[model samples]
Target: MTHVQDGGPAYWRVAIVEDHRLQRLRTEELVGRQPGLRVVRSCETLDELMAWMAGGSPQSLPHVVVLDLVVDRGRDADPAVVERLVRSGMRVLVLSAMASVPLVRAMIRAGVTGFVGKRDTEEDIVAALWAVLRRRQWITPELASVMAGDAQRPRLSDQEERALVLYASGLTLDAVAVALGVKRDTVKKYLERVKTKYADVGRPVRTKIDLNREAIRDGLMTASTVENDRR
Candidate 1:
């Protein structure tokens, strides 16, 4: 499908999920000023978003959600929210400063169609929204380059990389722990750390292998990257 930058006279309903008041309002304003987009609601937390969606009438529900990976510092964004929005027939266009190769990949794998980093220009942001409106996957060129460059170079501990690869390989937490000769919780913690790095960027954390898959796809983390780091 084509990207939604044609300046067409089509209107798309949108919702915003951001904890920062100013950022949320600014984004809402930008969407409001756009020709084919309108903001139905602006949320500052996941609970609020959930409650609104649950209690609000379907007519008020948005057609698209501008979701941020971090709604609250300690609270990780749940994949279930994205799933719920999609299940409810709302398209998600993630807009965040927390763009990471692994995070983007996980979001994409989880069915998000558009991702635009906050570092992107206004044009990039607009193009991204339009892309998602037209049912196309959009990633900022700058972010794409960063992802590509990072994939080719990384700084990670051997054990950490091993943990990531094994987790990505579909091994259960227990299985990974057994194979690594560490406590299950130890393995779990290691994996959680990897997730936290990406989470710090306001993106969902997936399994280590899943993270690696994202890295591999972005040319950031590879099978060899994992293997070489293990030594």
Candidate 2:
């Protein structure tokens, strides 16, 4: 949770992991220009960054990591990666276009130091990094309010979230399996896990109708979906 400052270097070493090529380059330039902050690496994926770290240099250690919350179009970066960075004594600051409440909550639960929306101003983005380096939690007002309002919402895994969205959108188990490239029984287990999590959080979803209702309430369903087909 803490960034080791003393005896490290003259400036803070930062690593950027973003999916978009242009954004990654821009961020690397931005962070490198800041006083007392140096961008050690700008990687397109967490795996790439991990590979760089594995190559091993005394300077390979990063004091802070800025990662896109979801990469490759709605696919969330594994929370286990976040935990690994935090345990290695790196402060993680999420920089993303923003995603669903459940996914964002899942990342927060994984021990992120801050979250910043892509639409935010450059100054605020820099501010978030400094705040995170100072061992303080930073989040945009909009995200903070959203998280606070849904503070009791259950954190769903990537597969569980996908299952909820698909099933709640009127897809049958077989159809969901096809979309997810998994077996029908695998899709069913995903739904079952989602239901258990929801129940654990005091929102019991005992039927498809109930699942649809909960999905809508959690912003997983689009506004056009006012009602699911009763068939």
Residue-pair clashes per candidate, as listed?
6, 0
lDDT per residue (tens digit) for residues 1-231 in model 1: 122446633467788888888888889888888866778889876567778888888777788888888655546456656756665567788888764456554555446768787777778888888788777778666655654464333433334555665677566788777655589899878877767765665555575545866556534344664565355
Candidate 1 segments exceeding 4 Å error: 1-10, 72-74, 99-101, 150-231
Clashing pairs in 1: 4-130, 98-201, 151-219, 151-220, 167-209, 168-209
Residue 170 deviation, candidate 2, in Å? 34
Model 2 lDDT vs. the true structure?
0.79
Error of 1 at 24 (Å): 1.0
Model 2, 82-105: lDDT tens per residue?
A: 867776668989999777666676
Poorest lDDT segment (10 consecutive residues) of candidate 2 = 222-231
Worst 10 residues of 1 by lDDT: 150-159
